[model samples]
Target: MCENAAVTSTDGQQSPPPAPVVPLTDAWLVIPLFNEAQVVRGVIEEARRVFPLVVAVDDGSRDDSAAQAAAGGAVVVRHPLNLGQGAALQTGITYVLERTDANFVVTFDADGQHSVADAAAMVQAARDEDLAFVLGSRFLQGPSPVGWLKRLVLKTAAVAASHTTGMHLTDAHNGLRVIRRDAAARLDLRQNRMAHASEIIRQLGATGLPWREFPVHIAYTDYSKGKGQSLWNSINILVDLLFS
Candidate 1:
C-alpha cells in the first residue's frame, strides 16, 4: 500500500489527509529491457529518484543493457535466451514477488516512453483508493499526438480487447501500470509477446479487481518510434488472439 507523501491545509482546516506517499522499499518498479542500452541507464536513474527498488529484466539483450541497468542501481534479472516482453515481465514480476518483500509491482517499458511522475502518482492513487491495479491512459485528457494510422490501429485493438474482456478500457496496451501484490498474485500470464498486453486486460477484467486508468503522457522520441510496434503487428495480434 501507499504511505502518505505530504499533507495540505485549507481555509483554517486541514483537508482530509491526502494520499500517502508510497515508499520505494514497498514497491518494485519492473522495467523490461531488450537492447535499450542507450537510454536504459538514464531511465533507471530517473525511476530510482521516485522509487528506490527497481528490477530491470534484461530479455537476453545483445548489448550491455543488463550492465547498464545494474550500474544504474537496479537489480538485474536476465533471461538465458531472448524472450518476448511478456516473458521478460513475467521473469521480473516473479522475481520481485518471490524474492523481495515488495507489496506492489509496476510494469514499465524500458523504451523511455513511460513517465515516472505519472507512475508515482498512480502508486499513491492505488494506495489511497485501495485498488488492485492502476492503468495509465493516453486518452483521458483527449487524444495525444499519435499518428492517424497508429490511432486507428490502437483503437481497433482496444475495442477488440474491450469487447473480449467485457471491460471498458480507454487504452488497453499502455505499458505504465501499478499492480498490487494481491492482484498481481492472481495473474496467470501465458502470452509471451505483445499479445500479453491484451492477456493482462482480460485477466484483470476476469478477476474483477478494483481498477481505473489515469492520464499519462508518452514521449515518442526517435528511439522509441524505432522500437515501437508496427501497423502490421495489429493484424498479427488479432490473429494470435484468435488462434495462438
Candidate 2:
C-alpha cells in the first residue's frame, strides 16, 4: 500500500476519519437610526439573535438613540450632527470594514419593519451563492406593508433605476441588503438624501458587482406610514439623480 493510503487488513477492512464542522461567522448586522429611539431596541435585539456583531449608527438623533442602542447590546456609533441615512450607513460600514474581520455586512432599517431572521437568511443566501451584493425585495415575492402611493413611487423608481443603470432589480429602495467587503469598499455614497438608493444601483452597475435579489417581509406600521418619505422628497431625489 502507498504511504498516502490507509493500511487495511487482509480482509479489506478500513477506517475513515471524521469530517470537521466549520463554524458560521462572517456577517455583521448594521442598523442606521435617525430619531428612531422607539423601535431601535427591538431591531437590535432581533438582529443579535443571528449575528454576533450588531452595530447601530445614531445619525445625530436628538433623542436617546445612542444610549438605547448601546443598552440593547449593539456596538453604537454616533454622529455629532444629523447626517443623511446614506452617510450614516456608510459610516457604520466603514467602521466595521476597518475594525472587524467581517467578510459581509448587512444594512438594515432601524424602524420595526425589517425582520432580523430574514436578514440572517439573506446573509446565508449570499454565502451560498458567493454574491457580492444581495438586495431584499418586497414586490418580487409577496405582500408589502407600504401604502399605495408609496408602492407606486417605489415601482416607478425601480423602473427608472433599471433604465438608468441597466440593472434588473425589483425594488431599488428597500433598506435591507447584504454586501461583501469588496463591494462595500468600492461603494462611494456621496448623496446625502434619499436618492442614494438610486445611486447604489448605479454604483453596482459601474463596479460590475455580482449581486442577487431575495424576498423579505416588511411590516409598515402606522408610525412608519406617518413617517414615510413625501412626494416632494421623491422630486428632490429625482433632481439628485439628474444632477448627481
Candidate 3:
C-alpha cells in the first residue's frame, strides 16, 4: 500500500517497473579468456556496465568459462582446442572487426588485473587526443607495486621492445590497450604465446600512427599474482623478442 509500491493488476497480481536502460559506449571490449571460471564472469559483468559490447574468446577452457561469460552478457566465442592467449586475442579482435561497427576496440585482461575505469579513461583519451592507440603504462605516475625482480624484468622488456620496435614504451607487456578501428585493423599477431605482447608493440609501431601511453594502476591481487608469468616464462619472452 506504499506510494512507491508495485501496482496491483486487475487479476490481483503485482507488476514492478521496468529496469532502467544503460546507454552503451561505442567501444567493444575484447577479452581473451582461458580457465578463469572464478573471475571472468564478474569481470565481464562489471565491464558491461560501462562498455556494453563485450566479446570473450574462450581458448578451450577446461571449466565453464564460456558459459559464465555468456551469462554475463558477453558474446562468447569458443576455441575447440586450447590455443594460446595471443590466438584468443586475435580471435576476439577479428570477431569485433568482422561483426561490429565499433569505432574502438579495447583489449582487456580476463583475470581482473586491469581496471574498467582505466579502460574508459584510455578510450576517452584516444577520442580527445585523436590518438590511434592508447597503451597502458604502470610506470608513468610512479613506481608500480611489483617486486624488484618483476619490475627489473618489465623494465628490461620495455627497453628491449623499444630498441627493436622504435617505439618508446614504459610498460610494453601491459595487457590493457585502447586501439582505434583503423589502427587495430593493421594488427597481425603471429606470436601465439607471451611473446605476442612484444609482437603487438612491433606491429603497432609499424603502423606509424599517433599513440601515447596512459598511466594505469594495476591491481596485483593474490589471484592475479598466482596467474602471473614466472621468471622462466619472462626469459623466454625476452628470447623470442631477441630472435624474432
Candidate 4:
C-alpha cells in the first residue's frame, strides 16, 4: 500500500488543531528529465497550468534542463549523478513525500508525448475509482502512431502481462500513470533503465494493487520520435522479462 495516502483538498484548509488533513488539493507531478533541455520547459509549464505543485527531477543532465524546469515553475530536484529513469522518479516521489502535502503522485515523461490535460484527467479518474494505480494507453481507443513493429512489440508485451497477471490491460508500458501514495511506497524499483516499465507491471501483479488503464494522447512529435526507444530496446525488454 502507498505510505503517502492522505485526503487533500485544493483549498489550503485542514480540519482542526492537531489538524485534520483537508483532502489534498495538491498533487505532485513527478517528471524525470534526462538530456531533454529543449522540451522540458514546455512540459513543466503545461504541468504547472494544471497542477500547482509539479516537481521535475533532473537526472544529471549536462544541459540546463534543471534550471529551465525551475524557471518554468517546477520544483526541481537534481541528482548528483545519472542514476536512470527509475532513480529519478524515486527521487521526485520521495521529495514530494517529505517536502509537501500531496494527495497523489503522478509520473509523466519529460518527452513531449504526454499532455497536461490528459494528466489532469488521470487524476480525476483516480479520484473516482479510488484506485491505487492507473496506466495510460495509446492503443486502447484507436491505432497507435508508433511504427507497426514497435506497436507489435508493445501489444505482445501487454498481452503477455495481461495473461500473466490476469489483468486485461492493453497498455502496460505507458509511462503516464497516476499512483496513490501508498501504492507508490510499495513499489520497489530495481530496474534502472527502460526495463522499469516492465518492473512496475510485475510489482503490481505481485502486490495485487488495484489497477486500471485509461487512454491518453501520446503526441509523437519529430523530437519524441527521434528519442524513442529503438525496436531493439523492445527486444531487450523481452529478454529481461524472460530472465527476470
lDDT scores in order: 0.84, 0.81, 0.89, 0.80
Q: Candidate 3 — worst ten consecutive residues by lDDT sum?
A: 17-26
Better candidate number, 2 or 4, judged by lDDT? 2
Steric clash pairs (candidate 1): 3-20, 3-21, 4-20, 4-21, 5-21
Candidate 3 per-residue lDDT, tens place, 1-244, comes to: 5545677899999899545544447899999998999998899988888889999999999999999999999999999999898899999999989999999999999988899989999998999999999999999997788777767778899998899888888989999999999999999888888889988998999999999999999887888677664455567766766676
Each model's total of backbone clashes: 5, 0, 0, 13
Every model's TM-score: 0.86, 0.84, 0.87, 0.84
Candidate 2 displacement at residue 18 in angstroms: 25
Instruction: Locate the minimum summed-lDDT window of 10 residues in model 2.
Output: 15-24
All candidates in order of lDDT, best leading: 3, 1, 2, 4
**Over the stretch 64-182, how does candidate 1's per-residue lDDT look in tens digits?**
99999999999998897988888888888898879988888999988788888899899889999999999998888976977777676677778988999787888887889899998
- Candidate 3 residue-wise lDDT at 118: 92
Q: How accurate is candidate 2 locally (lDDT)?
A: 0.81
- Cα distance off (Å), candidate 1, residue 118: 0.3
Instruction: Kindly report the root-mean-square deviation of model 2 from the true structure over all alpha carbons.
Output: 9.5
Q: Give the alpha carbon lDDT tens digit for every residue of 14-86 in model 2.
A: 7553333233368887788889888788778766766768888889999998988998898999899988988
RMSD vs true structure, all candidates: 5.5, 9.5, 7.5, 9.7
Residue 26 accuracy (lDDT) in model 4: 59
